[model samples]
Target: MPKPEPTELSRPYWDALREGHLVFQRCSCGNAWLPARRHCPHCLKPEPRWERSSGKATLVSWVVYHTAYHPAFESRLPYNVALVQLAEGPRLLTNIVDANEALVADAPVELQIEWEGDTALARFRLAHVTV
Candidate 1:
């Protein structure tokens, strides 16, 4: 798997995930987003604070990939790339683990951090699934 190169602005987010927490930036004007940015996409306000997430989200949409565009992903063909809307209102592009063709939109999901080398990634699984 590939590793993420954290920039000065996004280091906090990556670090938090490494510590087992998901976070996003929110502006006082009531807008929230991910992939950390300098200002609110809604109000364009600077200094959006990093806030921890509840790790709860809903499957908004997704598509199953039948082909691997990257060499690193070749072994994981037929994977699902999903758009999950966080309970706190930010949407993230992530993968749905243990997913199949039976997956549907609006299904509730919870965060599950996985590691690749020393990097931590925020993945998700169906909330009601038993382990």
Candidate 2:
């Protein structure tokens, strides 16, 4: 697995995830986003504050990849790359773990942070699926 290189702007996000907290930037205009942007995509205001997520989300769309575009990912072939809309309104590109079959659109999901080596990532699972 590849490691994440966090820039200064994205450090807070990665750091929060490492502490088992999912956070995003929220603008005064009622917009929230991920991947750490300095300005709100909607209002163009700077310094959006970091807010913790409820860890709740909905599956918007996804595709199962049977082939790895990179050799490092070959061992994890047949994975799902999903677009999940967080309850706070930001959509994120993430993987749906333990999804053996097709996931239904709008299925509720919850955050399940995991580590790749020492790097933490924000992944999710079906709300109904148990650990």
Candidate 3:
């Protein structure tokens, strides 16, 4: 597997994930996103603050790939890549930790930190909330 090479701007995000927290950049204009950019993806402002997520999100969409786009992923073929919108408004591309057939639009999900070698990755699973 190809490990993430954290750049200066993205280092904090990766470091936080390593410490078991999921965070995003929140601009003054209220836009938030992942994969750390220098400017707000919505308003084009600089140096947004990082905010820890509540670890809740909603399933937006997904696709199950039968073929590995990279040789490192050949063993995990048929995995689903998903789009999830966080409770705080930003959306990210991630994988759901459940059966591909169980996915549905708008399903509530919660964060589940997973590891790829030494790198921490943020994946999700159906929320198991208790009343």
lDDT of each: 0.92, 0.90, 0.93
**What lDDT score is found at residue 24 in candidate 2?**
92
Lowest lDDT block of 10, candidate 2: 98-107
Q: Against the correct fold, how does model 3 do in TM-score?
A: 0.94
Q: Clashing residue pairs, candidate 3?
A: none
lDDT of 2 by residue, 1-131 (tens): 76878999999999999999899999989988987999999989998999999999999999999989999889988888999999998889999996649588989999999998899999999998566
Tens-digit lDDT track for model 1 on 77-111? 88999999999999999999965776788999999
* lDDT at 32, model 2: 88
Candidate 2 vs 3: which has more lDDT: 3
Model 3 scores what on Cα lDDT? 0.93
TM-score for all predictions? 0.95, 0.94, 0.94
**What residue pairs are clashing in model 2?**
none
lDDT of 2: 0.90
Best by lDDT: 3
lDDT by residue for model 3 (1-131), tens: 98878999999989999999899999998888987899988889898999999999999999999999899989998899999999998899999999999999999999999998789999999997687
